[model samples]
Target: MSSNAALLFQGGIGVIGLVAMLLFGIPVLLVGPGLWPSILLGALGASLTYAALLLLTRVPGLFPENLERQMQGLYDFASSYSPVVLILLSLLAGVGEELLFRGAIQGWLMANTDPVTAVLAASVLFGLVHYVSFTYFLVATGLGLILGAAYVLSESLVLVMVWHALYDMIALYCLLRFPRWFGVRIVDPVTNRPHE
Candidate 1:
Protein backbone atom coordinates (compact mmCIF):
# COMPACT_ATOMS: atom_id res chain seq x y z
CA MET A 1 0.00 0.00 0.00
CA SER A 2 1.04 3.59 -0.57
CA SER A 3 2.59 5.29 2.40
CA ASN A 4 -0.16 7.91 2.34
CA ALA A 5 -2.78 5.21 2.54
CA ALA A 6 -0.82 3.53 5.28
CA LEU A 7 -0.74 6.79 7.18
CA LEU A 8 -4.50 7.18 6.87
CA PHE A 9 -5.07 3.61 7.96
CA GLN A 10 -2.78 4.02 10.96
CA GLY A 11 -4.44 7.32 11.80
CA GLY A 12 -7.71 5.43 12.03
CA ILE A 13 -6.10 3.21 14.61
CA GLY A 14 -5.33 6.25 16.72
CA VAL A 15 -8.92 7.33 16.36
CA ILE A 16 -10.15 3.94 17.42
CA GLY A 17 -7.86 4.09 20.43
CA LEU A 18 -9.19 7.48 21.34
CA VAL A 19 -12.76 6.29 20.99
CA ALA A 20 -12.04 3.28 23.13
CA MET A 21 -10.46 5.45 25.76
CA LEU A 22 -13.46 7.73 25.83
CA LEU A 23 -16.01 4.94 25.78
CA PHE A 24 -14.21 3.13 28.55
CA GLY A 25 -13.71 6.35 30.48
CA ILE A 26 -9.98 5.79 30.83
CA PRO A 27 -8.03 8.87 31.77
CA VAL A 28 -6.14 10.29 28.78
CA LEU A 29 -3.42 12.17 30.57
CA LEU A 30 -1.18 9.35 31.58
CA VAL A 31 1.68 11.23 29.96
CA GLY A 32 4.17 12.61 32.50
CA PRO A 33 7.69 14.05 32.64
CA GLY A 34 11.09 12.41 31.96
CA LEU A 35 11.20 13.04 28.24
CA TRP A 36 14.94 12.63 27.79
CA PRO A 37 15.11 9.41 29.71
CA SER A 38 12.18 8.07 27.77
CA ILE A 39 13.93 8.69 24.46
CA LEU A 40 17.14 7.01 25.60
CA LEU A 41 15.25 4.15 27.15
CA GLY A 42 13.17 3.71 24.01
CA ALA A 43 16.33 3.58 21.90
CA LEU A 44 17.78 1.04 24.27
CA GLY A 45 14.68 -1.10 23.95
CA ALA A 46 15.05 -0.97 20.18
CA SER A 47 18.69 -1.97 20.40
CA LEU A 48 17.88 -4.90 22.65
CA THR A 49 15.17 -6.05 20.30
CA TYR A 50 17.61 -5.93 17.40
CA ALA A 51 20.14 -7.94 19.31
CA ALA A 52 17.50 -10.49 20.24
CA LEU A 53 16.50 -10.91 16.61
CA LEU A 54 20.12 -11.44 15.67
CA LEU A 55 20.56 -14.06 18.36
CA LEU A 56 17.30 -15.81 17.60
CA THR A 57 18.02 -16.03 13.90
CA ARG A 58 21.35 -17.67 14.67
CA VAL A 59 19.74 -20.52 16.57
CA PRO A 60 19.49 -23.52 14.23
CA GLY A 61 15.99 -24.90 13.61
CA LEU A 62 14.48 -22.12 15.67
CA PHE A 63 13.44 -19.83 12.83
CA PRO A 64 11.60 -21.81 10.21
CA GLU A 65 11.92 -21.34 6.46
CA ASN A 66 8.28 -20.36 6.08
CA LEU A 67 8.54 -17.67 8.75
CA GLU A 68 11.63 -16.32 7.03
CA ARG A 69 9.72 -16.20 3.75
CA GLN A 70 6.86 -14.30 5.35
CA MET A 71 9.26 -11.84 6.92
CA GLN A 72 10.93 -11.27 3.57
CA GLY A 73 7.58 -10.48 2.00
CA LEU A 74 6.88 -7.98 4.75
CA TYR A 75 10.31 -6.43 4.32
CA ASP A 76 9.68 -6.00 0.62
CA PHE A 77 6.54 -4.06 1.35
CA ALA A 78 8.08 -2.03 4.14
CA SER A 79 11.15 -1.17 2.09
CA SER A 80 9.04 0.24 -0.69
CA TYR A 81 8.32 3.32 1.38
CA SER A 82 10.49 6.32 2.15
CA PRO A 83 12.28 6.31 5.48
CA VAL A 84 10.39 9.39 6.59
CA VAL A 85 7.06 7.81 5.73
CA LEU A 86 7.98 4.58 7.43
CA ILE A 87 9.07 6.48 10.51
CA LEU A 88 5.81 8.36 10.48
CA LEU A 89 3.93 5.10 10.28
CA SER A 90 5.95 3.84 13.20
CA LEU A 91 5.00 6.91 15.19
CA LEU A 92 1.35 6.46 14.35
CA ALA A 93 1.42 2.79 15.22
CA GLY A 94 3.25 3.61 18.41
CA VAL A 95 0.74 6.20 19.49
CA GLY A 96 -2.32 4.36 18.25
CA GLU A 97 -1.38 0.90 19.42
CA GLU A 98 0.16 1.91 22.74
CA LEU A 99 -2.84 4.08 23.43
CA LEU A 100 -5.32 1.26 22.97
CA PHE A 101 -3.33 -1.71 24.17
CA ARG A 102 -1.48 -0.04 27.02
CA GLY A 103 -3.54 3.03 27.80
CA ALA A 104 -6.99 1.55 27.41
CA ILE A 105 -6.89 -2.23 27.69
CA GLN A 106 -3.90 -2.52 30.00
CA GLY A 107 -5.00 0.46 32.00
CA TRP A 108 -8.42 -1.07 32.45
CA LEU A 109 -6.85 -4.38 33.36
CA MET A 110 -4.57 -2.77 35.92
CA ALA A 111 -7.54 -1.08 37.48
CA ASN A 112 -9.34 -4.39 37.84
CA THR A 113 -6.37 -6.75 38.16
CA ASP A 114 -2.75 -6.66 39.23
CA PRO A 115 0.07 -5.08 37.23
CA VAL A 116 1.53 -8.40 36.13
CA THR A 117 -1.83 -9.63 34.94
CA ALA A 118 -2.47 -6.42 33.09
CA VAL A 119 0.88 -6.53 31.32
CA LEU A 120 0.61 -10.18 30.34
CA ALA A 121 -2.99 -9.88 29.21
CA ALA A 122 -2.39 -6.80 27.14
CA SER A 123 0.85 -8.18 25.68
CA VAL A 124 -0.87 -11.39 24.63
CA LEU A 125 -3.60 -9.40 22.96
CA PHE A 126 -0.98 -7.28 21.24
CA GLY A 127 0.77 -10.39 20.05
CA LEU A 128 -2.48 -11.93 18.80
CA VAL A 129 -3.37 -8.95 16.68
CA HIS A 130 0.08 -8.82 15.10
CA TYR A 131 0.31 -12.55 14.61
CA VAL A 132 1.76 -13.58 11.28
CA SER A 133 3.55 -16.67 12.48
CA PHE A 134 4.05 -18.31 15.81
CA THR A 135 7.57 -16.94 16.03
CA TYR A 136 6.32 -13.51 15.12
CA PHE A 137 3.59 -13.78 17.69
CA LEU A 138 6.20 -14.49 20.30
CA VAL A 139 8.36 -11.63 19.12
CA ALA A 140 5.48 -9.18 19.04
CA THR A 141 4.37 -10.35 22.45
CA GLY A 142 7.88 -9.76 23.72
CA LEU A 143 7.80 -6.27 22.32
CA GLY A 144 4.45 -5.65 23.97
CA LEU A 145 5.94 -6.73 27.25
CA ILE A 146 8.74 -4.24 26.78
CA LEU A 147 6.29 -1.44 26.11
CA GLY A 148 4.13 -2.49 29.02
CA ALA A 149 7.12 -2.47 31.31
CA ALA A 150 8.05 1.01 30.24
CA TYR A 151 4.53 2.15 30.99
CA VAL A 152 4.59 0.52 34.38
CA LEU A 153 7.95 2.06 35.19
CA SER A 154 7.07 5.64 34.27
CA GLU A 155 3.28 5.55 34.30
CA SER A 156 3.59 7.46 31.08
CA LEU A 157 1.93 6.43 27.87
CA VAL A 158 4.33 8.84 26.21
CA LEU A 159 7.29 6.73 27.26
CA VAL A 160 5.88 3.50 25.89
CA MET A 161 4.82 5.31 22.77
CA VAL A 162 8.40 6.38 22.28
CA TRP A 163 9.65 2.89 22.96
CA HIS A 164 7.18 1.21 20.65
CA ALA A 165 7.72 3.65 17.83
CA LEU A 166 11.49 3.53 18.15
CA TYR A 167 11.41 -0.23 18.21
CA ASP A 168 9.38 -0.36 15.01
CA MET A 169 11.40 2.28 13.24
CA ILE A 170 14.63 0.56 14.20
CA ALA A 171 13.32 -2.81 13.14
CA LEU A 172 12.28 -1.54 9.74
CA TYR A 173 15.56 0.24 9.32
CA CYS A 174 17.48 -2.89 10.17
CA LEU A 175 15.38 -5.17 7.98
CA LEU A 176 15.89 -2.96 4.97
CA ARG A 177 19.38 -1.78 5.63
CA PHE A 178 20.85 -5.08 6.79
CA PRO A 179 18.69 -8.05 5.85
CA ARG A 180 21.55 -10.46 6.45
CA TRP A 181 21.62 -9.39 10.09
CA PHE A 182 18.52 -11.54 10.49
CA GLY A 183 19.94 -14.35 8.26
CA VAL A 184 17.95 -13.29 5.18
CA ARG A 185 19.55 -12.84 1.75
CA ILE A 186 17.39 -10.37 -0.14
CA VAL A 187 17.91 -7.35 -2.35
CA ASP A 188 18.43 -4.18 -0.39
CA PRO A 189 15.60 -2.08 -1.74
CA VAL A 190 17.47 1.20 -1.34
CA THR A 191 20.56 0.15 -3.26
CA ASN A 192 18.71 -2.19 -5.63
CA ARG A 193 21.24 -4.92 -4.93
CA PRO A 194 21.80 -7.70 -2.47
CA HIS A 195 23.72 -7.03 0.71
CA GLU A 196 27.42 -7.83 0.69
Candidate 2:
Protein backbone atom coordinates (compact mmCIF):
# COMPACT_ATOMS: atom_id res chain seq x y z
CA MET A 1 0.00 0.00 0.00
CA SER A 2 1.02 3.58 -0.50
CA SER A 3 2.62 5.36 2.44
CA ASN A 4 -0.29 7.77 2.69
CA ALA A 5 -2.69 4.87 2.71
CA ALA A 6 -0.75 3.17 5.41
CA LEU A 7 -0.74 6.27 7.55
CA LEU A 8 -4.46 6.69 7.12
CA PHE A 9 -5.03 3.09 8.08
CA GLN A 10 -2.99 3.50 11.23
CA GLY A 11 -4.88 6.64 12.16
CA GLY A 12 -8.12 4.80 11.66
CA ILE A 13 -7.06 2.07 14.01
CA GLY A 14 -6.30 4.55 16.76
CA VAL A 15 -9.74 6.10 16.38
CA ILE A 16 -11.40 2.72 16.47
CA GLY A 17 -9.57 1.76 19.62
CA LEU A 18 -10.63 4.98 21.29
CA VAL A 19 -14.22 4.47 20.31
CA ALA A 20 -14.35 0.90 21.51
CA MET A 21 -12.93 1.86 24.87
CA LEU A 22 -15.48 4.59 25.39
CA LEU A 23 -18.37 2.33 24.52
CA PHE A 24 -17.51 -0.24 27.17
CA GLY A 25 -15.71 1.73 29.87
CA ILE A 26 -18.27 4.27 31.00
CA PRO A 27 -20.51 1.69 32.64
CA VAL A 28 -17.79 0.28 34.83
CA LEU A 29 -17.40 3.61 36.54
CA LEU A 30 -21.05 3.56 37.53
CA VAL A 31 -20.92 0.07 39.00
CA GLY A 32 -18.39 0.58 41.79
CA PRO A 33 -15.87 2.94 43.37
CA GLY A 34 -13.05 0.46 43.79
CA LEU A 35 -12.11 0.48 40.13
CA TRP A 36 -10.93 4.07 40.24
CA PRO A 37 -7.87 3.35 42.32
CA SER A 38 -6.94 0.46 40.10
CA ILE A 39 -7.10 2.78 37.13
CA LEU A 40 -4.93 5.36 38.85
CA LEU A 41 -2.30 2.89 39.93
CA GLY A 42 -2.17 1.31 36.51
CA ALA A 43 -1.36 4.70 35.01
CA LEU A 44 1.34 5.38 37.53
CA GLY A 45 2.87 1.94 37.08
CA ALA A 46 3.06 2.40 33.34
CA SER A 47 4.81 5.74 33.76
CA LEU A 48 7.33 4.18 36.10
CA THR A 49 7.95 1.42 33.62
CA TYR A 50 8.77 4.03 31.00
CA ALA A 51 11.24 5.65 33.36
CA ALA A 52 12.91 2.32 33.98
CA LEU A 53 13.17 1.72 30.25
CA LEU A 54 14.86 5.08 29.82
CA LEU A 55 17.34 4.28 32.56
CA LEU A 56 18.06 0.90 31.03
CA THR A 57 18.87 2.62 27.77
CA ARG A 58 21.44 4.80 29.52
CA VAL A 59 23.79 1.90 30.23
CA PRO A 60 26.84 1.77 27.95
CA GLY A 61 26.09 0.27 24.56
CA LEU A 62 22.49 -0.26 25.61
CA PHE A 63 20.69 2.40 23.69
CA PRO A 64 22.24 2.67 20.25
CA GLU A 65 20.22 5.65 19.09
CA ASN A 66 19.79 9.09 20.62
CA LEU A 67 16.66 8.22 22.58
CA GLU A 68 17.18 11.04 25.05
CA ARG A 69 17.21 13.56 22.25
CA GLN A 70 13.93 12.17 21.02
CA MET A 71 12.50 12.51 24.51
CA GLN A 72 13.53 16.14 24.64
CA GLY A 73 11.68 16.79 21.42
CA LEU A 74 8.61 15.23 22.94
CA TYR A 75 8.96 17.38 26.02
CA ASP A 76 9.19 20.42 23.83
CA PHE A 77 5.85 19.68 22.23
CA ALA A 78 4.23 18.76 25.52
CA SER A 79 5.42 22.06 26.91
CA SER A 80 3.73 23.87 24.06
CA TYR A 81 0.27 22.92 25.26
CA SER A 82 -1.49 24.47 28.22
CA PRO A 83 -1.70 22.55 31.47
CA VAL A 84 -5.42 21.96 30.94
CA VAL A 85 -4.95 20.37 27.55
CA LEU A 86 -2.20 18.14 28.85
CA ILE A 87 -4.33 17.02 31.75
CA LEU A 88 -7.26 16.31 29.49
CA LEU A 89 -5.11 14.31 27.12
CA SER A 90 -3.70 12.35 29.99
CA LEU A 91 -7.13 11.60 31.43
CA LEU A 92 -8.59 10.50 28.15
CA ALA A 93 -5.68 8.28 27.27
CA GLY A 94 -5.02 6.83 30.71
CA VAL A 95 -8.52 6.29 31.94
CA GLY A 96 -10.11 5.47 28.64
CA GLU A 97 -7.59 2.92 27.44
CA GLU A 98 -7.16 1.18 30.79
CA LEU A 99 -10.89 0.91 31.24
CA LEU A 100 -11.25 -0.81 27.91
CA PHE A 101 -8.20 -3.04 27.90
CA ARG A 102 -7.53 -3.89 31.52
CA GLY A 103 -10.85 -3.04 33.12
CA ALA A 104 -13.10 -4.64 30.58
CA ILE A 105 -11.13 -7.40 28.88
CA GLN A 106 -8.63 -8.37 31.56
CA GLY A 107 -11.17 -8.04 34.32
CA TRP A 108 -13.49 -10.37 32.50
CA LEU A 109 -10.79 -12.91 31.79
CA MET A 110 -9.61 -12.99 35.38
CA ALA A 111 -13.16 -13.66 36.55
CA ASN A 112 -13.24 -16.95 34.69
CA THR A 113 -9.61 -18.11 34.62
CA ASP A 114 -6.23 -17.94 36.29
CA PRO A 115 -4.53 -14.56 36.58
CA VAL A 116 -1.67 -15.56 34.29
CA THR A 117 -4.00 -16.85 31.64
CA ALA A 118 -6.21 -13.79 31.98
CA VAL A 119 -3.29 -11.42 31.62
CA LEU A 120 -2.01 -13.23 28.56
CA ALA A 121 -5.39 -13.18 26.92
CA ALA A 122 -6.01 -9.54 27.78
CA SER A 123 -2.57 -8.49 26.59
CA VAL A 124 -3.11 -10.10 23.22
CA LEU A 125 -6.48 -8.41 22.89
CA PHE A 126 -4.95 -5.12 23.93
CA GLY A 127 -2.34 -5.47 21.21
CA LEU A 128 -4.91 -6.38 18.60
CA VAL A 129 -7.16 -3.49 19.64
CA HIS A 130 -4.51 -1.09 18.37
CA TYR A 131 -4.01 -2.85 15.05
CA VAL A 132 -1.60 -0.77 13.00
CA SER A 133 1.51 -1.81 11.09
CA PHE A 134 3.37 -5.00 12.05
CA THR A 135 6.08 -3.17 13.92
CA TYR A 136 3.45 -1.10 15.68
CA PHE A 137 1.61 -4.27 16.64
CA LEU A 138 4.74 -5.68 18.23
CA VAL A 139 5.33 -2.52 20.15
CA ALA A 140 1.71 -2.42 21.24
CA THR A 141 1.97 -6.01 22.42
CA GLY A 142 4.99 -5.20 24.52
CA LEU A 143 3.18 -2.23 25.92
CA GLY A 144 0.17 -4.40 26.66
CA LEU A 145 2.29 -6.80 28.65
CA ILE A 146 3.61 -3.94 30.74
CA LEU A 147 0.12 -2.54 31.32
CA GLY A 148 -1.25 -5.95 32.14
CA ALA A 149 1.53 -6.59 34.60
CA ALA A 150 0.80 -3.32 36.35
CA TYR A 151 -2.79 -4.36 36.89
CA VAL A 152 -1.84 -7.77 38.20
CA LEU A 153 1.05 -6.49 40.28
CA SER A 154 -0.80 -3.77 42.11
CA GLU A 155 -4.31 -4.85 41.32
CA SER A 156 -4.81 -1.25 40.35
CA LEU A 157 -5.69 0.34 37.05
CA VAL A 158 -4.65 3.84 38.05
CA LEU A 159 -0.97 3.17 37.53
CA VAL A 160 -1.43 1.79 34.07
CA MET A 161 -3.74 4.66 33.15
CA VAL A 162 -1.16 7.29 34.05
CA TRP A 163 1.58 5.37 32.33
CA HIS A 164 -0.46 4.96 29.18
CA ALA A 165 -1.29 8.66 29.11
CA LEU A 166 2.28 9.78 29.62
CA TYR A 167 3.53 7.30 27.09
CA ASP A 168 1.08 8.43 24.42
CA MET A 169 1.52 12.10 25.24
CA ILE A 170 5.27 11.82 24.90
CA ALA A 171 4.99 9.90 21.65
CA LEU A 172 2.33 12.20 20.21
CA TYR A 173 4.27 15.28 21.15
CA CYS A 174 7.42 13.88 19.58
CA LEU A 175 5.72 12.80 16.38
CA LEU A 176 3.78 16.00 15.93
CA ARG A 177 6.49 18.45 16.88
CA PHE A 178 9.84 16.74 16.55
CA PRO A 179 9.72 14.14 13.81
CA ARG A 180 13.44 14.41 13.14
CA TRP A 181 14.35 13.52 16.73
CA PHE A 182 12.65 10.18 16.27
CA GLY A 183 14.82 9.48 13.18
CA VAL A 184 11.84 9.83 10.92
CA ARG A 185 12.58 11.46 7.58
CA ILE A 186 9.81 11.73 5.06
CA VAL A 187 11.91 10.75 2.12
CA ASP A 188 10.61 8.66 -0.71
CA PRO A 189 10.64 5.12 0.69
CA VAL A 190 11.51 3.78 -2.74
CA THR A 191 14.76 5.76 -2.82
CA ASN A 192 15.57 6.12 0.89
CA ARG A 193 18.97 4.82 1.97
CA PRO A 194 21.40 5.21 4.82
CA HIS A 195 24.49 7.35 4.45
CA GLU A 196 27.66 5.27 4.31
Candidate 3:
Protein backbone atom coordinates (compact mmCIF):
# COMPACT_ATOMS: atom_id res chain seq x y z
CA MET A 1 0.00 0.00 0.00
CA SER A 2 0.99 3.59 -0.50
CA SER A 3 2.36 5.48 2.51
CA ASN A 4 -0.62 7.75 2.80
CA ALA A 5 -3.00 4.83 2.45
CA ALA A 6 -1.10 2.99 5.16
CA LEU A 7 -1.38 5.94 7.48
CA LEU A 8 -5.08 6.26 6.83
CA PHE A 9 -5.51 2.58 7.57
CA GLN A 10 -3.69 3.00 10.84
CA GLY A 11 -5.88 5.95 11.66
CA GLY A 12 -8.92 3.81 10.94
CA ILE A 13 -7.68 1.20 13.36
CA GLY A 14 -7.25 3.89 16.01
CA VAL A 15 -10.77 5.14 15.47
CA ILE A 16 -12.15 1.63 15.66
CA GLY A 17 -10.24 0.96 18.86
CA LEU A 18 -11.70 4.09 20.40
CA VAL A 19 -15.22 3.29 19.30
CA ALA A 20 -14.91 -0.22 20.64
CA MET A 21 -13.76 1.13 23.96
CA LEU A 22 -16.70 3.45 24.15
CA LEU A 23 -19.28 0.93 23.00
CA PHE A 24 -18.01 -2.21 24.64
CA GLY A 25 -17.46 -1.05 28.21
CA ILE A 26 -16.79 2.50 29.36
CA PRO A 27 -19.65 4.53 30.72
CA VAL A 28 -20.17 7.76 28.84
CA LEU A 29 -20.23 9.53 32.16
CA LEU A 30 -16.79 8.25 33.22
CA VAL A 31 -15.13 10.09 30.33
CA GLY A 32 -17.24 13.19 30.77
CA PRO A 33 -15.59 16.57 31.41
CA GLY A 34 -14.66 17.67 34.91
CA LEU A 35 -13.40 20.80 36.71
CA TRP A 36 -10.05 22.58 37.07
CA PRO A 37 -7.90 19.79 38.48
CA SER A 38 -8.57 17.69 35.43
CA ILE A 39 -7.09 20.13 32.97
CA LEU A 40 -4.34 21.27 35.32
CA LEU A 41 -3.11 17.79 36.20
CA GLY A 42 -3.36 16.62 32.61
CA ALA A 43 -1.14 19.37 31.26
CA LEU A 44 1.27 18.94 34.16
CA GLY A 45 1.61 15.21 33.63
CA ALA A 46 2.08 15.53 29.86
CA SER A 47 4.65 18.31 30.22
CA LEU A 48 6.60 16.31 32.77
CA THR A 49 6.65 13.29 30.49
CA TYR A 50 7.86 15.35 27.54
CA ALA A 51 10.59 16.93 29.64
CA ALA A 52 11.77 13.55 30.89
CA LEU A 53 11.94 12.15 27.37
CA LEU A 54 13.83 15.17 26.05
CA LEU A 55 16.38 14.94 28.82
CA LEU A 56 16.75 11.20 28.45
CA THR A 57 17.36 11.53 24.73
CA ARG A 58 20.12 14.09 25.27
CA VAL A 59 21.95 11.81 27.69
CA PRO A 60 23.58 9.16 25.54
CA GLY A 61 23.39 5.53 26.78
CA LEU A 62 20.53 6.41 29.09
CA PHE A 63 18.19 4.23 27.05
CA PRO A 64 19.13 0.72 25.99
CA GLU A 65 20.23 0.38 22.36
CA ASN A 66 17.37 -1.90 21.43
CA LEU A 67 14.92 0.50 23.02
CA GLU A 68 16.41 3.41 21.15
CA ARG A 69 16.15 1.56 17.87
CA GLN A 70 12.56 0.60 18.54
CA MET A 71 11.66 4.16 19.41
CA GLN A 72 13.45 5.45 16.34
CA GLY A 73 11.50 3.09 14.17
CA LEU A 74 8.29 4.32 15.68
CA TYR A 75 9.20 7.93 15.15
CA ASP A 76 10.17 7.23 11.56
CA PHE A 77 6.84 5.64 10.89
CA ALA A 78 5.01 8.51 12.56
CA SER A 79 6.93 11.09 10.58
CA SER A 80 5.72 9.45 7.37
CA TYR A 81 2.22 10.62 8.15
CA SER A 82 0.72 14.08 8.14
CA PRO A 83 0.36 15.99 11.37
CA VAL A 84 -3.42 15.71 11.24
CA VAL A 85 -3.30 11.93 10.98
CA LEU A 86 -0.79 11.71 13.78
CA ILE A 87 -2.94 13.87 16.01
CA LEU A 88 -5.99 11.74 15.40
CA LEU A 89 -4.05 8.58 16.19
CA SER A 90 -2.70 10.18 19.34
CA LEU A 91 -6.14 11.26 20.45
CA LEU A 92 -7.58 7.83 19.83
CA ALA A 93 -4.81 6.22 21.82
CA GLY A 94 -5.33 8.62 24.67
CA VAL A 95 -9.04 8.01 24.90
CA GLY A 96 -9.03 4.26 24.31
CA GLU A 97 -6.10 3.41 26.56
CA GLU A 98 -7.21 5.65 29.40
CA LEU A 99 -10.73 4.29 29.34
CA LEU A 100 -9.56 0.70 29.44
CA PHE A 101 -6.51 0.91 31.66
CA ARG A 102 -7.35 3.70 34.10
CA GLY A 103 -11.10 3.87 34.02
CA ALA A 104 -11.87 0.17 33.75
CA ILE A 105 -8.90 -1.80 35.00
CA GLN A 106 -7.41 0.53 37.62
CA GLY A 107 -10.70 1.85 38.78
CA TRP A 108 -12.03 -1.65 39.35
CA LEU A 109 -8.85 -2.72 41.12
CA MET A 110 -8.94 0.31 43.38
CA ALA A 111 -12.23 -0.93 44.75
CA ASN A 112 -10.69 -4.19 45.92
CA THR A 113 -7.03 -3.30 46.43
CA ASP A 114 -4.95 -0.53 47.95
CA PRO A 115 -4.29 2.49 45.80
CA VAL A 116 -0.64 1.58 45.40
CA THR A 117 -1.42 -2.00 44.47
CA ALA A 118 -4.07 -0.92 42.05
CA VAL A 119 -1.77 1.53 40.34
CA LEU A 120 1.09 -0.93 40.11
CA ALA A 121 -1.11 -3.70 38.85
CA ALA A 122 -2.66 -1.55 36.20
CA SER A 123 0.69 -0.10 35.24
CA VAL A 124 2.22 -3.54 34.80
CA LEU A 125 -0.56 -4.55 32.50
CA PHE A 126 -0.26 -1.29 30.69
CA GLY A 127 3.43 -1.87 30.18
CA LEU A 128 2.86 -5.40 28.97
CA VAL A 129 0.63 -4.20 26.15
CA HIS A 130 3.48 -2.12 24.74
CA TYR A 131 5.95 -4.96 25.05
CA VAL A 132 8.27 -4.13 22.18
CA SER A 133 11.45 -4.55 24.21
CA PHE A 134 12.43 -4.58 27.87
CA THR A 135 13.43 -0.94 27.72
CA TYR A 136 10.23 0.07 25.99
CA PHE A 137 8.26 -1.89 28.53
CA LEU A 138 9.96 -0.12 31.37
CA VAL A 139 9.44 3.29 29.84
CA ALA A 140 5.78 2.57 29.25
CA THR A 141 5.44 1.23 32.77
CA GLY A 142 6.98 4.40 34.15
CA LEU A 143 4.56 6.44 32.11
CA GLY A 144 1.73 4.32 33.44
CA LEU A 145 2.87 5.15 36.94
CA ILE A 146 2.76 8.86 36.28
CA LEU A 147 -0.57 8.66 34.49
CA GLY A 148 -2.03 6.40 37.14
CA ALA A 149 -0.90 8.69 39.95
CA ALA A 150 -2.37 11.65 38.15
CA TYR A 151 -5.65 9.87 37.78
CA VAL A 152 -5.80 8.73 41.38
CA LEU A 153 -4.72 12.01 42.87
CA SER A 154 -6.96 14.11 40.70
CA GLU A 155 -9.81 11.60 40.41
CA SER A 156 -10.09 12.54 36.80
CA LEU A 157 -10.03 10.07 33.94
CA VAL A 158 -10.49 12.86 31.45
CA LEU A 159 -7.36 14.49 32.77
CA VAL A 160 -5.22 11.45 32.27
CA MET A 161 -6.58 10.96 28.77
CA VAL A 162 -5.62 14.47 27.87
CA TRP A 163 -2.22 13.95 29.41
CA HIS A 164 -1.63 10.77 27.45
CA ALA A 165 -2.74 12.35 24.16
CA LEU A 166 -0.76 15.56 24.56
CA TYR A 167 2.27 13.61 25.64
CA ASP A 168 2.04 11.53 22.49
CA MET A 169 1.60 14.63 20.35
CA ILE A 170 4.71 16.22 21.79
CA ALA A 171 6.73 13.05 21.34
CA LEU A 172 5.57 12.69 17.76
CA TYR A 173 6.37 16.30 17.03
CA CYS A 174 9.87 16.02 18.45
CA LEU A 175 10.66 12.71 16.79
CA LEU A 176 9.46 13.88 13.39
CA ARG A 177 10.74 17.45 13.42
CA PHE A 178 13.94 17.11 15.46
CA PRO A 179 15.39 13.67 14.98
CA ARG A 180 18.99 14.84 15.21
CA TRP A 181 18.52 16.35 18.69
CA PHE A 182 17.32 12.97 19.88
CA GLY A 183 20.04 11.02 18.04
CA VAL A 184 17.53 9.32 15.84
CA ARG A 185 18.59 8.51 12.29
CA ILE A 186 15.52 7.72 10.33
CA VAL A 187 16.34 5.25 7.60
CA ASP A 188 14.42 4.12 4.61
CA PRO A 189 12.93 0.77 5.44
CA VAL A 190 13.56 -0.79 2.03
CA THR A 191 16.98 0.65 1.24
CA ASN A 192 18.19 0.75 4.85
CA ARG A 193 19.83 4.10 4.17
CA PRO A 194 19.44 7.37 6.05
CA HIS A 195 16.15 9.06 5.12
CA GLU A 196 16.58 12.51 3.64
Index of the highest-TM-score prediction: 1
True-vs-predicted CA distance for residue 109, candidate 3, Å: 0.7
Better of 2 and 3 by lDDT: 3
What is every candidate's alpha-carbon RMSD to the true fold?
A: 3.0, 7.8, 4.1
TM-score of candidate 3 relative to the true fold: 0.78
- Model 1 agreement with the true structure over 75-156: per-residue lDDT tens digits: 8788789889998999999889988899998988888899999999999999999988888888789888978877887777
Q: How do all the candidates rank in terms of lDDT, highest first?
A: 1, 3, 2
What tens-digit string does per-residue lDDT give for candidate 3 at 1-196? 4556655654564465456555655432243346566777677879888998777766767777555577677876787677888887788778777877887777767877888998999999999988888888888999999888878877778898889999988889877888876557877789989977
| Candidate 1: stretches off by over 4 Å | 63-66, 187-196
lDDT of candidate 1 at residue 196, scale 0 to 100:
72
TM-score for each of the candidates: 0.86, 0.56, 0.78
TM-score pick, better of 2 and 3: 3
* lDDT values, one for every candidate: 0.81, 0.61, 0.77
Local accuracy of candidate 2 as per-residue lDDT tens digits, 84-185: 666566557666667767777777667668778878887887778765444445556778888787677766565666678887765565455555544544
Query: How many clashes does the backbone of model 3 have?
Result: 0
